[model samples]
Target: MKLTTKELMEIIPHRQPFLLVDTIEELEPGVRAVGHKCVTYNEPFFAGHFPGEPVMPGVLQIEALAQTGAAAILSLPENKGKTAYFGGIRQAKFRQKVVPGDVLTLEVELIKVKGPVGIGRAVAKNQKQQVTAAAELTFMIG
Candidate 1:
């Protein structure tokens, strides 16, 4: 299913300036999600991150990934109204710089789930299909 920004807000609690994913292109409720983040020079982080050479923070990319993962797990009927908290991050790697005018394709897949905890595999890629960052994210639902 496809989700607009407003619909995304229903599944994930985030707002402008902090809401990273603009749209969800694909999703499988409690399993996986593919989303997008369009990078622009107007982003507030760009100003402090660098004066002239701005790059999206690696941490933000990871957060975007987590949010996308949240969309998947939290969409479940049993999970609605719940929040996901970061439990851990594993094997995170930044492969390239994400700059202005780039549309980031974020893909997150649920790898395992047990009780209120789960793990997801996430990756962010640019328009050219080059991986920008990747990591295994662990989260706990509450």
Candidate 2:
């Protein structure tokens, strides 16, 4: 199912300036999720990341992917009201620069899950479908 930003706030405990995902294009409960983020020139990070050359921070891209993954896990009935925390990151890679006016598409799939711990494969792409970053993320449900 698709979820808007307002609906996402219910499942993901993130607020503006930090709530990177704008909407979930698809969701499979604890399996996977595809989401989006619209990058704008006004993003606070742009000012310091570079005076005139603004690039979406690689960490934020991964976090966006993680948030998408969280939506998948947290949307499950059993996980309702629970919080998902980052346990670790692995195999992270940045392939391209993400700048203003780009609509970042994020996809994350749960590859393994045991009890309150889980691992997910995630990737972020720009509007042109160019991968901006990718990584394996581990999470702890609390």
Candidate 3:
């Protein structure tokens, strides 16, 4: 199922300047999800990330993907009303620079969920499907 930013706001606690996801295109409990983050030159971070050349930070890409995964898990009845906080990251790698006008596609797949903890693999790509970053993220639900 797909969710707009408003619906996503209800599922994830992140707010403006931090809520990287613009919309969720696909979602499947304990499985996978696809979300979007549209990069614009007007973004606050762009002003300082670099004076003339603004590149979306790699960590933000990972966070964007992780947020998508959190949304998927949070959508479940068992996780509703709870928060998913980042526990750790593994094998994170940045492959390219993400700049203004780029639509970041975040794809995540749940690897395991036990108790209040979950692990997942996530990747961020551009409109052309070129991977910009990827990582294994651990989340602690509360």
Query: Candidate 3, overall lDDT?
Result: 0.92
Task: Show where candidate 1 strays beyond 4 Å.
Answer: none
Residue 67 C-alpha lDDT in model 2: 95
- Compared with the true structure, model 1 gives a TM-score of 0.98
Q: Compared with the true structure, what per-residue lDDT tens digits does model 3 show for residues 1-142?
A: 9999999999999999899999999999768889999999988888989988999988889889989999989999878888999999999999989999999999999998988888999999999999999999999998
Per-residue lDDT tens digits for candidate 1, residues 1-142, read 9999999999988888899999999999989999999999999999999888999999999999999999999999999988999999999999999999999999999999998999999999999999999999999998
What Cα-based lDDT does every candidate model obtain?
0.96, 0.96, 0.92
Q: Please, what are the lDDT tens digits per residue for candidate 2 over residues 1-142?
A: 9999999999989998899999999999999999999999999999999888999889999999999999999999999999999999999999999999999999999999999999999999888889999999999999
Let me know the TM-score candidate 3 reaches against the reference structure.
0.98
Could you tell me every candidate's TM-score relative to the true structure?
0.98, 0.98, 0.98
